[model samples]
Target: ELERMNQEINRIGVNINQITHNNNSALYSREDKHRLYVFLKQIKTLVSQVQERL
Candidate 1:
């Protein structure tokens, strides 16, 4: 579980980074930006919980 969570955390981090870069680049539609933002936040919360489990 910890290993899976760790991999997910890394994946989330990559997604967050890509979205952030795209956001900075001013390329995403407003809705996509909002969705990615929400996803990133959820990923963060999940990572936190996973860390506690660890």
Candidate 2:
């Protein structure tokens, strides 16, 4: 179970890295910012779920 959580976290990290890279290569817009915020919220929820399980 711990290993699964670790894998999930790593996947989120990769997604974040990709998003950051894209943001770096482009200009920030309201939509992109909002999308990033939503994505981060999802990550936060997943983390909370993992914590609860542990």
Candidate 3:
């Protein structure tokens, strides 16, 4: 009985680790996307300014 309980505990620990890893990856991806969006916006603004000057 004790062995079975230990096995279950180990399995739960592994599942938690996997979930944490997936969450971190998702957060990193979201941050990267946000940064890219901001960079594109800046480029668009610069282009508009240059167009106005011309």
Which of the numbered candidates is closest to the native, going by highest TM-score? 1
Candidate 3, 1-54: lDDT as tens digits:
656655755675575567557666775477766775575577567556755755
* Residue pairs with backbone overlap in model 2: none
| Alpha-carbon RMSD, candidate 1 | 1.5
Report the candidate with higher lDDT, 1 versus 2: 2
TM-score for each model: 0.75, 0.70, 0.47
Scanning candidate 2 in windows of ten residues, the lowest lDDT window is 21-30
- Candidate number with the higher TM-score (1 or 2): 1
Clashing pairs in 1: none
Candidate 3 local lDDT, residue 41: 72
Better of 2 and 3 by lDDT: 2
Error of 3 at 9 (Å): 0.3
Number of clashes recorded per candidate:
0, 0, 0
List candidate 3 segments past 4 Å from native. Answer: 27-54
CA lDDT of 9 in candidate 3? 52
- Candidate 1: tens digits of C-alpha lDDT, residues 1-54: 767767877887787788788899999999998888787788778767876876
Which segments of candidate 1 are over 4 A away from where they belong?
Answer: none
Candidate 2 stretches with Cα past 4 Å from truth are none
